[model samples]
Target: MTNGIRVSVVAPVYNAGPFLHAFVNSFLIQTLPGDSIELIAVNDGSTDDSAAILDDFAREHQNVHVIHQENSGWPGKPRNVGLAAARGDYVFFADPDDEFGGPEALERLADFADEHASDVVVPKMVPRGDRLYAQWRYETTQIDADLVTCFTTLTPQKLFRREFLLDQDIRFPEEKVRLEDGQFLSLAYLKASRVSILNGYDFYVIIHHPQQDHLSAKPVDPANYIGSVAVMAENVEKYCTDPDTGDRIINEIYFRKVLANFTNSRVATHSLERRQAWQRQQKWFIDRFITTSRFEKMDEIAQVRTDLARDGDLDAIVAYARAGSVDFTFVSARSKRGNIELAGKLSGGFSDGELPKLVVIDRNDKSRIVTIPIQLAKSQVTVQIPKETLPLMEGARRYDLWLSPGRGHQNRRIEGPDRPFSLHFTDDRDVELYSTKKGNLSIAVSRGMSTQARTKRKLKRIIGR
Candidate 1:
């Protein structure tokens, strides 16, 4: 009750004793002042010392509440137990195996929710072992009053209004063993007065365990997921009174849940029973709408384009890239310097004034672009190097063009940055780029050069003897 709104966090546990201390301690350590955060944990009959850890935390901190429940194979039951005891004005749910990326994640969400008058605020979820989420303006947060109306398919990354949950009786379908997260969220948003989407700036570190479906060792359970999705579709069609909204949600359940998952992991070797289950379930969903030329044309074109641009081809990729629109704005720190103008077809080159961000990071420094997407077809683009970009080379090695999103990360490289400092007329269509720290250039992709031949060529070019 620090700011007069109670934030009740509910975490469920099975055999998560190994992570229990870290999870609870992190939540308790950075707690805000009074009227702020309180935690409620349900130790769902964990086979290990999970209950002991929860009890210890509760004993130590008055704000911690622990509930013990019998071993229930039902995945949704533990969540239900935790949700029942949450007394805060707003509630957040976490699995015992997963914990917060930063102590400040909740505080930031609270502040954003208050400022925007939002009922649900989602934080960006980043997985473990990768770079954390980047900060962005909260004005980027999007919202929809009806759950079915959200254009984005991003799943539960939110803090929910407790009252909103209770009033709508938003509880999990314990009967359905799988896809409970999808099922619960779909219903909650159905009754939500206002749902807000916060951009991905917060991180949640999820530790994969064998027992969890995400890291399951058992055979696939498409049947259970089909049940979960069917429930969602039925709820939307029956309860969501808006026709267009219903159709959109229906489409999302098909595309985002079923098809998208299929693309990611559903394989050909699943048991025939499970495959048949998925197809039978899909038929019920397909009956919701008739095929139309509008959607069909777009789908057909997307399929054709994807087929033509299969992942294996690179030159066809380069040709496709050499066709994107580009903008080349230039600035220089030095005036009246060697005039840097468009050399030829690449007219978008920068004028002599200052260096671009790309050049500054690409110099003989310890830097490269990371996590950039690669696509085909680059339009005309040009860049001019500013003297400022070339920091004094001390033991500098090589220059690199790293295509992070590509198969082989090092797309191009230039060894030793003394000459040919220019990386112009680049084929950018096949890549997305955001620079990281710069260091000695290390261009691994050779433009077909051998050590002896290169030395002779350099001798000829340098001496002109």
Candidate 2:
């Protein structure tokens, strides 16, 4: 019988001094049996006062121990160090910036662990704010699977049997510079049994630090993500049941991990060469997955565009549109002439040629212009953005969506319309549209365009003064 399971919560600290206190305190707030729950705080060579922070906590509480290590090149090495130090039979990994769903959730999860004798127990997530939706990786509904569901999407949401991890020789790839959380899960899931899932507990408070995207600032290289994705793809190909299943499994991993390079690029502070290198590296990595045929999927395009944009590739947008990454639709009523406009009698297109690549998004399909290029000799030109490219924005912080145009650094700045307005391009060609809310609401225009001023004013009106 599984001796009363020892629940060890693994908190990996690296320059986590800012949020270290509450993260540690969240555990202290839990209701688990005092002896049953353990906190293994790994201070992975934090240059900040993070080690001191953990040290302070460890001093206050015996469960919160710290493992000081050298400055490793990757996040996984420190986690591996922590894994060795984890004394509990079940290990719970937590990021210092995030928090548990609730104080009692861990206790409940531990109880569930005792009841099912599960190798992996997954918890759910709920959105913590306006711009962000909770990400639980696994499905919210009750799911029980040995390979697909258990071993696949639900990797991050579980409490793993430490022995199973050690027995299988499962270790976080120390070489991986990023996304190993997924890699770690994929590795362990294959050997797991009785993967139980628990709802009602959002075990982690994944913070969306808007100011910190690689686009807006420095980030670990996207190439590191490539290495991580490569590891996952190899693992998936080796362990999955069949070619189809393996493809799908690895496809999802490829989608998320590789897409990370792009997403991180989006957060970069400027269009620097370093960011471009990441994008280039990402493009190279994506080259592998693109041939998988699934790249043709709209979600695939969406993922690619996101990665590209994150990598700060404005040109990636052309690829995004060409790949049919934009899936938004328009409800346009056109004039006898080629001119196109919106439904509200506002901004209309002069010609089909005037309708540059545009994608219009709104609460409904009744949008005016979504920024998809369709040659309108004044005819309405519109298209849809794939669901992936325009993810729902609920709790993003400090988004720097600058949309100025022409080309390169010379594009003029253009904010989105003042309000959600309809279109009336030239004549009877009037329609309505909305832009996606997932990123910055700015757009740019070229000085070559004569109507740029009118376009900017109309947008200001549409976006609301």
| Cα lDDT, all candidates | 0.53, 0.56
The count of residue-pair clashes in candidate 1 stands at: 36
Runs of candidate 2 exceeding 4 Å displacement: 1-5, 127-139, 145-157, 194-197, 209-223, 259-465
Worst 10 residues of 1 by lDDT: 424-433
What is the TM-score of each predicted model, taking all chains together? Answer: 0.61, 0.62
Error of 1 at 212 (Å): 6.5
Candidate 2 at residue 72, lDDT?
Answer: 72
Query: Count of backbone clashes for each model?
Result: 36, 94
Tell me model 1's lDDT, rounded to 2 decimals: 0.53
The weakest ten consecutive residues by lDDT in model 2 span 403-412
